[model samples]
Target: MTEKQPQARVMIVDDQPMVLEKLRLVLGAHSDIVLHVASRAEEAVEAARSFRPTVILQDLIMPGIDGYELLARYREAEELAHVPVVILSAHDDAVAKERCFLLGANDYLVKLPETIELVARIRYHSGACISRTERDQAFHLLMVSQRELAAANVLLAKLNGIDELTGVGNRRSFDAAMAAEWSRAQRQSKPLSLVMCDIDLFKRYNDAFGHVAGDFCIKRIAAALTEQLRRPSDKLSRYGGEEFAIILPDTDQAGALLVAEGCRMRVEGLAQGESSSGLRSPVTMSFGVASLSPTRDSDMTAMVEAADAALFEAKRSGRNAVRHAMEMRAGQRLNA
Candidate 1:
């Protein structure tokens, strides 16, 4: 969608109604301008408050609260101070113009001047005012954009193990999270658990549905798995093609098993379309869980290997079952 351009707001302060009308008629042809008319200095100040003009054209000779006083008030106002004000009067004396300039009148113009000269001055002053406004706006926008970009970079850095296709954390992210959590667990002496999950018959499913469908299936499963981990310390990531890993900080074997079951159930409920071969069922995942206390001398590599082995056993036994690593190594002595 195209954005709308902003128009410049201008206020003309003069006691004479005829002069105000003339000024409007001269500048009205410029669609980018919004002209405000004020007949008194007090009225001009009120108009300035409401209109928030970028430029003010004020008459020097007024009945009360003359242009000089109005300019002083405008300078005192924090929001109105930056706005440029030009003095307009019938007195074309150099002394009067210089006094007005010293008192903060941006420029001085004689009344009933040539139309071309009037338009030229207005355009020139307005252009400078608009340029400054645009510079301030652009600086603010640049700051905002820089902040957003910094946030995005932080997110990207935290997303280890993310799958490039689906924008999910990849295996590397999962491993780093596990290592950090393990250290924390060792310090607090809390339980830590890991879950390794694989898509059932993913190779066959991919053969029947094409790689595109396979990718879709993986993304859906990854999203579902991530959704299951709502806790701040829980970590989920794509382990590899058609496989994912989950880290459950301060979770026992039973807790990990429940999380794995929930993820499995959610993936099975996705109701994806049929494969190209039209024989395979909708997507489903199998999980293997391992839990232990991470000690000072523990080896995370062995624990992850044990979880991976359990996942292989689950696949060997049945496609959609969850297996515990301790059960698989019941006859063998395993450390860490």
Candidate 2:
């Protein structure tokens, strides 16, 4: 099927009332073209801007800002730049046509061109202008869609790293962070600390209370543990159910022990009261602390296993104590 062309908007700029009326009367007979006439050079460009003309018919010798200057103004306007301008002058001088072309005129014609030719030029230019406008709008929409997609991908990646229940970094995120921190510590020869923690008697607590209350307890304990470390380099993650691991970059054994003890106290303070009785449920946690001056030869697994072994000792000695893996090794060496 053939597509119909949109209406052409033609604007005539001339100081002569007769010329303005003549162009208007001739062009007005065509139903497809809408006409606007400006008799002063001062207002012609502004009028065209507001009317949004598809084709401009400009006279070269008008008063106050000559037609050449008016043409320059229209060409400078971003909104009017794509609209084609046709110069209508009385003289057919080559120099005058060259000046108009240099000032960005699309066409030059002797005044009072044949009615058939003028309308044909206007329709042709208008159709091209409309097509360019549509193309620009489509390109702008495409750029916007690409930006929105990029932003959504960033948000999805962040969400994937976060634990939904505790609002802490999940196990996958912890592994990545541990590797990066380990490399940094090895490069700098700085001490790095790991603190592994488990909620004491958490199974018993969940058995006594409902699973929903247990989840709530876990979230509260996580927040308390997060508050213990003041350094921005420290990170906390949900390593397993009711088990959390802390990564302390550039921290020694003493600092790690202090942080673990602080976490233990804060969680113990979160003792929630039962509804049936005025007694609070015991909310103590056990901690296993390990620190190392990391080397390139060593990997994260050694540190993790050391912390896990210490955590087992803490659970074995009593549910609420803190155990240090390095300290236990020194004691064993002395006894041996």
Q: Which model scores highest in lDDT? A: 2
Candidate 1 per-residue lDDT, tens place, 92-156, comes to 89988877877778888888777788666666677777788789899999999999999999877
Give the clash count for model 1.
9
lDDT of 2: 0.86
- In candidate 2, clashing pairs total 0
Off by over 4 Å in 2: 1-52, 58-82, 87-110, 114-128, 207-209, 271-282, 327-336
TM values, all candidates: 0.61, 0.72
Instruction: Give stretches of model 1 more than 4 Å off.
Output: 1-61, 64-69, 72-80, 84-145, 158-161, 269-280, 327-336
Angstrom error of the Cα, residue 107, model 2: value is 5.4
lDDT tens digits, residue span 74-125, model 2: 8799999878999999999999999999999999999889999988988888
lDDT of candidate 1 vs native?
A: 0.80
